[model samples]
Target: AGGISEALITTAAGLSVAIPSLMFYRFFRRRVDELVLNMEEESLKLVEVIHGEREPDRTSEAA
Candidate 1:
């Protein structure tokens, strides 16, 4: 009986630490995804502008 209670206590403690860590990990992961997407969009825009300036004729080719 005592062993079971002690094990339960340890399980509860582990969960207490794990739940918040998991939540924080997910939140940061989402933020990173958003940032990466934003960077990708900006880079694509920059590339398009540069490419357009280099070749006005091929602007239609981009589409």
Candidate 2:
């Protein structure tokens, strides 16, 4: 009987720790994902501008 009670206490403690940890992990993961997505969008816009500037050089070369 004592062993069972001890086991139940340990299980409860584990769950208490695990639940908060999972919540924190998910919250941080969502934040990082948003940052990464924003960076990617900005990078794509920069690439498009650089590519647009190169068009004039290509036209001059053809002439």
Candidate 3:
């Protein structure tokens, strides 16, 4: 067993599994956050454009 105990092997295996899992989760979370932010910005731009178009109509109605 190369003088390795069960506890040592388990610990090493756990570290190997947990490190990659944590990295993958963080990477995906960041990507998702960026995607959501981009979507929100696009939505806001669309709303602003729509509001701008309606502004002239409202001004004409008021006049």
CA deviation > 4 Å runs, candidate 2 = 53-63
Instruction: State each model's CA lDDT, in order.
Output: 0.86, 0.84, 0.82
Between prediction 2 and prediction 3, the one with superior lDDT is 2
Q: Is candidate 1 or candidate 3 better by TM-score?
A: 1
Tell how far residue 30 is off in model 2, in angstroms. 0.5
Q: Report the C-alpha lDDT of model 3 over 3-58, residue by residue, as the tens digit.
A: 57887998999999999999999999999999999999767866876888433234
Clashing residue pairs in candidate 3 (N, C-alpha, C atoms within 3 angstroms): none
lDDT for residue 18 in candidate 2, whole number 0-100: 100
How far residue 19's Cα lies from its native spot in candidate 2, in Å, is: 0.2
The positional error of residue 35 in candidate 1, measured at the CA in angstroms, is: 0.2
The residue-by-residue lDDT of candidate 1 on 1-63, one tens digit each, is: 999999999999999999999999999999999999999976787787788854334554655
List ranges where model 1 is wrong by over 4 Å: 53-63
- Candidate 1 matches the true fold with a TM-score of 0.79
RMSD of 3: 8.4
> After best superposition, candidate 3 residue 62: deviation in angstroms?
37
